[model samples]
Target: MTAPPAFPAPHPSPLDLGGRTALVTGAAGGIGRACALRLADAGAKVRAVDRDAGGLEALAEEAHGLAGAVEPHVLDLTDLDAAELAAVGTDVLVNNAGLQLVRPIEEFPPDAFHTVLTVMLEAPFRLIRGALPHMYGQGWGRIVNVSSVHGLRASAYKSAYVAAKHGLEGLSKTAALEGAPHGVTSNCVNPAYVRTPLVERQIADQARTHGIPEERVLSEVLLQDSAVKRLIEPEEVAEAVAYLCGPQASFVTGTSLVLDGGWTAH
Candidate 1:
């Protein structure tokens, strides 16, 4: 076989998205909030979408003085049509909204499973469907799905979350293939357990599921498989999302940018 093409030299200028519009779901807080701010810092007009009106307000306030503005758009991704509509006229899309329930499959609530799948998997598809028109029209777009280690590897008590993320991984790749010719790229940022409100909320559920105290849950459960033995910061994962949207990643599509603290190394 012929040798692969040589990698190009790094660009000198920093990432600059002066007039682009970006929509980040779950922008109320955590990885999504960090992503909204990071993209705004790169001069992208960020539409921060989430169900938490107050949290979105706080995020908007925090993003003041950035290179670009953060416009809070209160949205519930489970509203599929609204989710798609909210993504209209956008350049970049970050699918990060999610819910988790730690319970055995036999004990899992069917409604909760459906909700997790809807928020984590189906909503991303709708958002992509909405964003594609504008992105295809402009001949450029970035779709970053904030997945997790659970997307790649399963855990005992997180059937719904694991299944949803795995499905997200597949959806991301499919988008990449279909959008490649249109100059749009789709990729997943698979981070390990992150230090966010979501994780904090899950601590109790995990504790109950694993029969461990809340205090021991972090070390014995969440970080057990991670070589780093610590939760990843939301900003760290956000930086990965920013990188995927930068010029450096124009050809980097249909891939998992795993930031799993070596959880998948095994």
Candidate 2:
């Protein structure tokens, strides 16, 4: 077999992914949507997968006229076998589908906890398992896990979310070690309070749980630990994902690219 062509100077800069195919879970909205669009902008054919069929349609509509195509794939990550099948043959994988239930340990439902781990942790493993053979065959691939600051630090009323993300971090690292020789890189992007439907939905829950008004949740709860004093944009996190999938990050593996705005500094 012939060797791959040499990457252009300033590799992955100018971030061209033309002819590549990327699969992004939870691609209906928020950071997932942003990542799908960003990858498509970089000329990658994107498989936008989500449980929300309408949202997927909207995402595909918005992706019109991009450098590459957006193919809508309606999938519920809870379906482990289907999730794995959805990932096959992709050159890039962004594991971003997640769910959150903010309640103290005692109040957290057992089923909810299981669902969190299944969607956030186990599904990623299966997706990676599904994507690996094709990636290994070509001797190149990228896996970017959308972890959270919770992955590294504990947070109140977030037992399930925290546990799942922490597990994802470990999974990402293990994949990195195994994928190294095959030219595949696995990494996590840790963000704090991204401005997405997930975070917006949490505001009211946080207010009620913390005995504060919804308006104050942003300052007193969400951004309190972040030195930047603001919510991060979905697009910003997507950019980091793109960078990881780029040629410049080939040597970057088994690590978390944190975009927490100093949340972990405390």
Query: Taking the tens digit of each residue's C-alpha lDDT, what string does model 2 give over 69-161?
Result: 899999888899999998999999999998888898899999999999999999999999999999999999999999999999999999999
Q: What is the lDDT of residue 9 in candidate 1?
A: 25
Note the clash tally of each candidate.
0, 0
Best candidate according to lDDT: 2
Tell me the spans in candidate 2 whose CA falls farther than 4 Å from its real position: 1-13
Question: In model 2, what are the clashing residue pairs, if there are any?
Answer: none
User: TM-score of the candidate numbered 2?
Assistant: 0.94
TM-score for each of the candidates: 0.94, 0.94
Off by over 4 Å in 1: 1-13
RMSD for all candidates, in order, please. 7.5, 8.0
lDDT (CA) per prediction: 0.89, 0.91
State the number of backbone clashes in model 1. Answer: 0
